[model samples]
Target: MSPSARRRQEAGGKTRPGSPRHFLRLDDLGSGEVETLLERAVALKAYRRTGVDHANLIRRVLGMIFEKPSTRTRVSFEAGIYQLGGHGMFLSPDDLQLGRGEPIGDTAEVVSRMVDGVMIRTFGHHRVEAFAAASYVPVINGLTDSYHPCQVLTDLFTWYEQRGSISGRTVAWIGDGNNMAHSWIKAAVLLGFELRLACPEGFEPDPAILEGGASHATVMRDPRAAAQGADIVTTDVWASMGQEAESDDRERAFGAYQVDSDLMAAAKPDALFMHCLPAHRGEEVTAEVLDGPQSVVWEEAENRMHAQKALMEMLLA
Candidate 1:
């Protein structure tokens, strides 16, 4: 077992036997700790491919609380739990007292007593922090307005599987610079990969996150500049779920940032194309590029299950 695995097994009190847990932010972990999780994920994926029964987390329960609607996040985590010999509880907003004016702290305190771990996909990063603060059990950030760490973890895992490593590679992100972009920035910082982000003037990622990642990344105005010599070119929708009113303006402003064939061609010949899905085909990415041979969107999606399974096992070992 790895050092992290050993440490998890030995940690006392709140961790309990087979119940290690985590929160939603990448900054919550040191670089070495992140590597430990990734290594475990790779091992788990390999074991599954070979049909090995490594269900170390059997009979555990992961309470999945979602304040927002989802497709991949819900299915991936639920299926991941079962694959690891555990079961998952999918709780929608209306299903919990949280939707009826109960405090997040109260909800957290109650859930911790009931579940081995909790994964919350919600609107604010602060809500996740509140849940973590109140709960004795582990809490995983499924997604938040500020970051989507799991998605980026899976994306990096997929990249690792395909290219072996990301230490010196350049990753170019082209789009609205939302939560996914923020998480990617965090990944670049922790993994020491060169990152370039291109977004419209006003629609950039959080300044704090950008500044924090600046020591390791290069933020730019031009998509082509970011894509130049990149090993991977990525994008997401121009307007996110709650930003519907800005859709028209965003499309106009982001016209120069589309990840079409021309932009992909500027990257390395073998550069992979990526998008956190629910893609806006013609708005942020052209159908040709998203459906192209180099696109790893589907593989990236699949890795979510593997990476999340590794996460649950690590937190609930």
Candidate 2:
């Protein structure tokens, strides 16, 4: 077992399983910490932009566990850690006993013993929570059925880079109220932003999730209305991972919610366009709008690495 793992097991920071801190959700960090993190992320991006090398995490190791396939999360994290002078080991359920029905906590205990931190992209939120409860190191929620915290964090960081603080800005969310929507709700509550979510009736965000953020968010049926005067127009696919079976129905239910030129026109003149991506053109968003002037998606996507590097530094430092 790694020395860090043995230390964690023998003594949690304050006698709790999550004593050192975990990024399982956005709420895990307070507003001040969030602000500090965003500033650090921007600095890291600029610092690396000049091709300078910094080895803050020299010789550290991070264990990345993915139960779902990813193009952005995997690549961004792998590249980010290497750039920070750490090694990231990618693991799949099939690579461990978790696929063979081993309890999540048991696997977490075993892995946290060998790595400096653990990042999990899995199907269930409970799975991530359970793993964190047993993990000896910091655990990051790469993605989960109920929340995509890391992606939203990167989005917020991108918005901060172009605009200013997102505290009072109006953000319109169009399409299925899935994990991305849920994570946005958490951000709204934490950062005091007005999140106008336009999702179809049956596809509305979980009431329990919205309830906590009710003061900062609104649920609307008309996508255009939500986008009107908004400072940011964002969306996600009608069907997320594992919901492919509902694609046909979701396509019908969400057809009217697409962020096209018309909808984009409803927002502020300089409103930013964002998508958590793997976006389906002509579906949740139009090809024109996605490729248009206001779209900072490529920058937003690239920020994932910078933002996550800052997050890793926050926890691992």
| Top candidate by TM-score | 2
User: What lDDT is reached at residue 132 by model 1?
Assistant: 82
How well does candidate 1 score on lDDT at residue 100? 95
Q: TM-score of every model?
A: 0.92, 0.95
lDDT tens digits, residues 1-317, model 1?
Answer: 86544544554544455533575887667777777777888888888899999888898899999998889999999989998999999998799999899999878867777778899999989999888866767899999999999988888888878887788899998877789889988888888988888887887889888999887766689899889999999988888878899888888999999899999999999999988788878888999999999999999888899998888887877
lDDT of each: 0.85, 0.90
Q: After superposition, how far is residue 305 of candidate 1 from its true place, in Å?
A: 0.2
Runs with alpha carbons beyond 4 Å of true place in candidate 1:
1-21
Candidate 2 to truth, TM: 0.95
CA lDDT for candidate 1? 0.85
